[model samples]
Target: MSGREFDLVLYGATGFTGLRTCQYLARNYKQGVRWAIAGRSASKLEEVREKLVNIDPGLSTLSIIQADASSPESLEAMAARTKVVISTVGPFLKHGEPLVAACVKQGTHYVDSTGETPFVLDIIRKYHKEARDKNIILVPECGFDSVPSELGTKMVVDFLRKEYNLPTKSVKLSVTKLRGAVSGGTLASICEVMEGKEGGMKDTLDQNQLVPEDVASKVVPARITLPSVFYDHDFKAWQAFFIMSFANEKIVKRSHGLAVEADGVGYGPEFTYRESMSAPGFFTAALASLGMGLGGAALSVGPLRRFIQNRILPAPGTGPSDESITQGHFTVKIIGESSLPENVPADASADALKPIKAIATIQGGEPGYSETCRYLVEGALCLVQNEDRVRNENKITGGVLTPAYAFGHILIDRLRAQNVNLTVSKL
Candidate 1:
């Protein structure tokens, strides 16, 4: 990888998130970080480069590579030139696999901001073994889809294990505050899922679907089913099903499964996880749940779906205004509880016998785009800067990995430095 032409390449650099990623790199460009922008249109790539130069004249020399998702040759060439690739292109089900294939073939690390669960499962099934054998990682859902949820869960689990010698029994995440607008790319992905394209929506319903078959077979399924709206005692807020919960939960579970497979222990043998968003009151929570349900149901209908995409949603490559992005923000709280330690006596008091708890929170700006770019860029940097630790110390032979599994505390440290706040404490 040291012989690669560039340290990183931002694929789909002309799209809304892609361009922001370029800007993020420009604003934070380190002296030795050699990077380039890549996409289908040379002109658009050039435009992005020019914008980057405007931010830091030092980026005037930033390179550009023209590659289209539709062309395998171009993708292969792009993969060959870079040690790592940050793909902002989606809906991943429609146009993501070829680039992933190219990266594995070239032994290049890869990351993407895809919330589509089926596509993730597809890639893991198809490429995990080969990528692992080659020692190159491929990570998806590095953005708002699952980073906060997945990594936040890790913070809680790690804290309990390190500080109290406890194995977690259950974890729940609540999006306590979210103020963000959707992007055309995100809407496109949602539309694909609702339409049952590729693997269909049913594939996402299985909680352990993303886990490897061998590990999943031995796993005990959690029996708790959250209602559409409920009151959460931990966060002390009315809760509703989070729009991204379906995707995030699976990613976190996959991380747990992979950890167990690698070391025979993960969060815990009976660890269960769930996610939801917070509302001010019970009525608001109910309305939010109803709205999400109705919106998903409507999108499943062909006529309604087309109308929404064509007439209502922003077109691909377009997104919220800069002001909107700056003003948007989100906060996720993760709570992990461990069962009583084996050493506890049967005569212990009721209070002493209670589960030990740890809480962690992830806070950042504009989840969909602004902070997401931070997550994506920082994730890539973590790979470039800590490749040895990831491969050797962590003993992680490359695979289709979740963010927590692939980068772990190195990524958490990077995000903290970038002001994507992550804090954990025992409760």
Candidate 2:
């Protein structure tokens, strides 16, 4: 890794998020941090480099590597040249596996902004053992799909343990404030998942399907069921089905599972995580819930999905207006409830033993694009700058990992420094 040609390589640099990530790197580029921009088109990569050079003239000399997701040899070459790779290419189900395989073959650490859970489960099942054996990590969903959800949950779990010395029993996350637009890449990925092209939506429904068998074995199956639309007393807001919850909840569960495997204890034996989008009133919540359900139903059908993809949604590589990207924002509120400690008196009244509670919030700008670029770039830097520390501190040998398990507090600190606020307190 020390002798690698570059410290990091931004693959798919021409894509919407990839271009944003390149700009982010240019604006925040540190001295002596060797990095390169790569994609299938040398011309597109050069164009991106030119834009970056405008931000910093020094980037005029920035290297460009021509690599395509379809070309395994090119991907391997790119992977071999860089110690770490950040991929923004999607819908990953169609074009992601080759690059991941190449990265693992080249022993390069990898990160991506993929939200497709079936693809993630596929990678974990196929490459986790080999990646672990090679001592290289591959972390997907480093972007808005689940980074905030996973990391926010970790913050609450840590608070419960440090403040009250109690294990977390349940954690609920609500997207209380979200003002953002969809990206073409994101929409494409959603279409693919809805079409059942990559292992189907069923793969994402069960928590056990997303994690390794050993880790899943220790998890206590959840018993409580939540409605699609409900009023949450904790947040005093009506809640609806959050589009990203299917992916986020599974990622959070995997993080907890990995923690349990690492230490024999995690959030807790009965820990369960659920997520929803908050609305101002019950009517809004109901409308949102119905809209999402209808949208999903439409996407699941062949003709309607094609119509939506071709006529309604933006094409791949395109996204929201710059103003939308600049003005968009989101806030997720996380609540963690503590379980009874083993030392509780046998005769203690149930009413007297109230579960301790903690709240954590993750705030950022433009969930689908701007803030996601920051999460993707910072996540890659965390791996680059704290490789040995993260591995040693977490007792992780490397594999397909969630953001919290892979970067933990290092990533949290990085995001905070970037003004992507993550805060926690006792309630």
Candidate 3:
């Protein structure tokens, strides 16, 4: 804790994901990282540090910060010296509140690998005001759940505006393919969230963040059916809601509402975004959707819940190796449609209103934990590189944002440079 505090302090560094992040930092930390690992155990912190040294001898300079989530004081101390804190600890309802409170109180910028919608809603309601008051940014879901979806939306919408000259009406996101080993942390997150939380979590939902007390009170997640015009048309398949739809769409809407040119490619003015899973046919899509819907509905029963618990992801903390991650990749084929709004444009032909085909695909590292870690690590880099980000003495905050708004180009470049080549190409 000398001059320049540290660039980033990785909390929960002993966890599976946190260890991976430290591994990433160690490999790429060619210059002054001014970094340290923080967790409950000094012993585990030292052990992780040794592993880092083994992977990259240049990481010998890495340091440690022993902090307990149970103690607000330790958390505050750890936050005090870091410009940013990337936390991979979760099931947040159980182990997250104290550290979050410390970050808000310390005015340190915070990011987390959490997809727990209820937990995010809780934090937003409870701390958004305090964070705003302190002029800090508490960004959540900088992980696999929403990063691709959010950034993917930005890329597609921007392309439509640039190449097709049309405002977007709606954007759909889905997991095209995901196959990887699971970890205990992932399993724990699934169980805590699937089982639902005590309504006490809602105590943190911020009324003034988006709506007034009166308006926010009645606000609900309004649902809409798929466009009849979309099915059996341009799309080669059917899709359904992503489990983490709440976080991704909400943040996209927030960013769209704040941006001046949100109209051009449907940031918010004429368009909205939804999430889903890609399926080969409508029948398969409906079945998968039903299965997910039923899972949510049935988690409350003891027998069903217990049955799931028995099927823990092939052993917790088990993840793909370096060889696999280096080989894995993803591509998002965005089918962009450009059309003239119907207002009786006399000269407009049906083809003129028809969707002119355009596509964008993002190339990135292999999916699952390693790729998720890569995205997470790159997301932190994006945050650091954002022009919109305003840094002060011991603090850096940004205006309203999603990862794309804050760090899209940086992440793309970094990911590409890291060998996860991405491209915008013809379909």
Candidate 4:
């Protein structure tokens, strides 16, 4: 690690999310954390550094490197120079593979803010074994798309294992509150998914791709239909479709699948996971459901998709005002239901057989922009500082991994220290 020129490198620093991530490093990491910012254009990278200088004058001396995703040699060079590389590049299905390949070749740890499930599944298929062999960690969705779902559920699963000595049968996550603004990068990623291209929305939504191929044929997720509002009496809130559901649900299930393959009792032999947004009331839930359904249907049509691309969504590099970013916040609640082993006595009382429920809440700053930056940078820092713990304690040395599977409690602890509220409780 000491031989590395930089502890970390911020790739795509010229993009909106990347620039904010640089500012975050400047503001938060003042204690000689050797880092650099890299992008396609040297001039643009310097411009971003100048902006960072405004945040911390000392950062004027920060190194700037020019690396383009299209140039495999440039990416390999960047990867070789750093211990970890954090990217805000997306729709990662297009520009992500080169950096990933370079990281594996260089044994550099990699993290990215990508919600594209197909990209993640493809990387797992192509590079998981190589990365494991090289002992280089590759993690994605460090941002809002599925961090809470992955880590929060892990919290619950771990808690159940410790307290009840039981495995989880079902876990449900609901977005109780989410307030954030989107950037052009986010919009572009969404558009690419809905664009009906080769690795587009339809293909990415396949849950079977999320798990290892050996398990993909065996594991079947407990499905929940979207755009149909329903009341979950446990939480006492109306539930509706969440836009990120297509990704998060699969990510959670993948975590379970990997855990099962690693150990006998994963989240559960019959582990099932689902997610939705909680509406204040039935009316609101219905409205949200209807709106999402209509929007999804419209995006599937060519004419409507063109109209959305031209008028409805922001261009790829734009973002919201600082005020909006600051004002943004989100909360997700995960409830894991536990069951006794099959060997339990048949004569057990109904109360004795009642399910044990473990609940966890993951709330933080805006899901998309400010908080996503926080999660990404903190995850990179975790990989840099606690790489040994992740490998030794979690027994996860390398692979294309979900955020929780990669960082686990090491990341949860880091986020809690940064004041991202997370807690587990009995319910």
Candidate 5:
């Protein structure tokens, strides 16, 4: 009998996102690293391995396991052999529940790339209790959808406590920079949900769970969501509508509920930040908003949703090229306000900017896939690597925790080492 078990198993390794995840694992794969490629197709897994072999001959040590998402027995079998299972198989509301159930029941740590907030909320509500008891980490949106943004927000809040004072009056995250196209898979998932093809994620909001349910919900969040037109005192930067409440808003809301120290800060002050890209002409911004308005509306109905998936994305596993993903750029510019006394001078107190602030960006081929693989895997790696002790310490886990709380300085240091753009920027 082979005594070795894989450290991580890449479930759904045959999808577009799955394939990219495998590529990332390959680049970071070490000789003794126990990892495997898994999905419904044996031939496709073999094909991916062959391509990997072309990239690096020594990767022959990589393993393969054929598992079908439809089969719970197969999922449970896959779960037992791995400490952590990072899955890219989504449209999750459609093809996910089985694997998640298996992981939780078997005491395996589970992570997935999902922005379907309602579906995740359902899983947590339905399974978080059991997983918590098992000490299993069931995290979703382990992708560009929110990890870095969530983790970055957590870092800024921690910085406030360590430097200026304990607990930030308020913290905010704005998309100062971001540019990318949605994939077919992304579009397809949206279409299904809009068309009612997606079931099992209806009560995410009332459940009060960001992605998980049954956790205490009275704490403050690390980041706040402001108005579309928040005031930036120093820079006087007036940000336009960056409609991210779709994913980020929910995560931030959950983070507030799961916080350990900043429980008093409340769900961050209302500040909606954005990177207004246009000709600076009123028409341009208006046009963009109109387009978004139309898209947003369509995202909820069957016809418009169907059109996007059919015309825009086209295939379930289709996405941008590796080169395109590698060449993308992302940015965020957030502005915050504090409880200033009457007559707070402008230039006189220019130095007194929101006790805490930060700008974080990750450059990669495809943020949704490539960079997400790096971020989520690193999150899992950080969690497993630094399970004991913390810069703050004495923090409790579970109940919709913040990424910073869950991962901490260990994660920040690791991300910086990976060359992610991180710094304290004003305005």
Candidate 6:
């Protein structure tokens, strides 16, 4: 048993997605779960608690505490009291490090829904070693941003390794169907990237900065251009640039790297990955690609970027209507290609050397908020419930980690229990 007073603490609980997360905990969290709601204002935290009580009247007695990003001491106190922390605070580049620092220092496990590549890379560079020493698991991208891609690919790689006894050589993921809008927090984080910080995505995207030197040296990534659209015969869909690819691809790479360095079970030494969304036809793909390119260009300009951030997008605390949340869903398909063993005879039949493929489908609801809440809350639960398994069975002691690196198949099992559809089959 953890020495902490609480099993979980939901920080930033007054924000749009944060409040939803509290409700999720109230409805689905097991009875006697010791949890609290926290944010900058005591009144706002109380308001959120009241709303949660409406969902589960028993929660009227649930705890509420004050902890602000600007108050490191408060964050420290909050961290010290919880076994695990689930943070929904974002533009994490701007408002996240304090809580992360406190968690690491306090020896608390931490998870967040951050897609800020620069922030994640910084965490890796600065805190991974220390967290490892302290037996702390610091996992980011515990939401829609990259969970499906990171863990979906892991599902494929795991299947291939088990079925054919071979490593995965290359993989492509296509968003086949999506019906969701971005959250205000996610948009804010994207705008923060466009506001142009030094050593931001540019540096993260420069040379696969997410992977360590030793692992990166063994793998060669396929060349991919984000502004281009094309046809993918294998998936039988027109493919277009995916804005989130920069982060998702790098995260999947980090998972593979950890497999080699920590577990010695990898997709292969030369594994490569790319991501795109499937379009109806070539025309739709071309138009979508052009729009994304133009949007990127517009966001890079100071005046346009400010106008979009200030006037057009939702505020950090706001979000789409509840009806929209109910109507939202997403599906992604990952195709994994097999790598031939080195000792295969040169005279082997063409059928023997032909690229074998497996497909993994990951589907869920209301990606930006609802499904994201499930992923985040379930991920936190995985840490709380399976920390010993991750440490002892998986031998994944600690580090700045992707969901797959931190929890392995344990997370997949948790999601399956939550009714998430994760299916894999040979193609």
**Where does the lowest 10-residue lDDT sum fall in candidate 3?**
203-212
Off by over 4 Å in 3: 1-3, 163-165, 197-221, 224-232, 240-247, 257-266, 281-287, 310-328, 336-345, 354-358, 385-401, 424-427
Rank candidates, lDDT, best first: 2, 1, 6, 4, 3, 5
Error of 2 at 64 (Å): 0.5
Higher-scoring candidate on lDDT, 2 or 3: 2
Q: Candidate 1 lDDT, tens digit per residue, 301-351?
A: 888899999999989888899999999988889999986787778788887
Per-model TM values vs. the true structure = 0.97, 0.96, 0.81, 0.95, 0.82, 0.96
Off by over 4 Å in 2: 197-201, 222-227, 345-352
lDDT per residue as tens, model 4, 304-414: 787898898888889998899889888999999987655668898886778889999988887788888888998998888888888888898688877888788999999
> Candidate 5, residue 3: CA error in Å?
8.2
RMSD of 2: 1.9
List per-prediction Cα lDDT, in the order shown: 0.87, 0.88, 0.63, 0.85, 0.62, 0.85
User: What tens-digit string does per-residue lDDT give for candidate 3 at 1-427?
Assistant: 1344876789988988889888878777666556778999999888998999987887776778899978889999989887678888876767887888888777677777886766776776688667766766676777776677666676666676777666655666555664455567776777777667333324113212332232332333334432121242434667754455555666655445434332232243445456556677777777777776676556656567667767734344555676766666665544444444556477887766665445555545555566677777777655444424434221334322345555555666777778864555323
- In the range 1-427, model 6's lDDT, one tens digit per residue, is 3688998999989998899888888889749578998999999988898888888988888888899999999999999999899999988999999999999999999999888888898888889899989988999998887899988798888888899888898888999998988777888998887776433335645436677666666667535445678899988999998888878888888888877776554678668888999999999999988998788778778788889888998888888889999999999999999887667798998888776799999999888889888888889988787778877767787888888878768888999998889999897
- What's the residue-level lDDT of 402 in candidate 6? 86
What ranges in model 4 sit over 4 Å off?
Answer: 197-205, 221-225, 341-349
Please count the clashing residue pairs in each candidate, in the order shown: 0, 0, 9, 0, 15, 0
Superposed Cα deviation of residue 337, candidate 6 (Å): 0.4
| Cα deviation of 141, candidate 6, in Å | 0.6
Q: Evaluate model 1: give its lDDT.
A: 0.87
**lDDT accuracy of residue 292 in candidate 6:** 86
Name the lDDT of candidate 3: 0.63
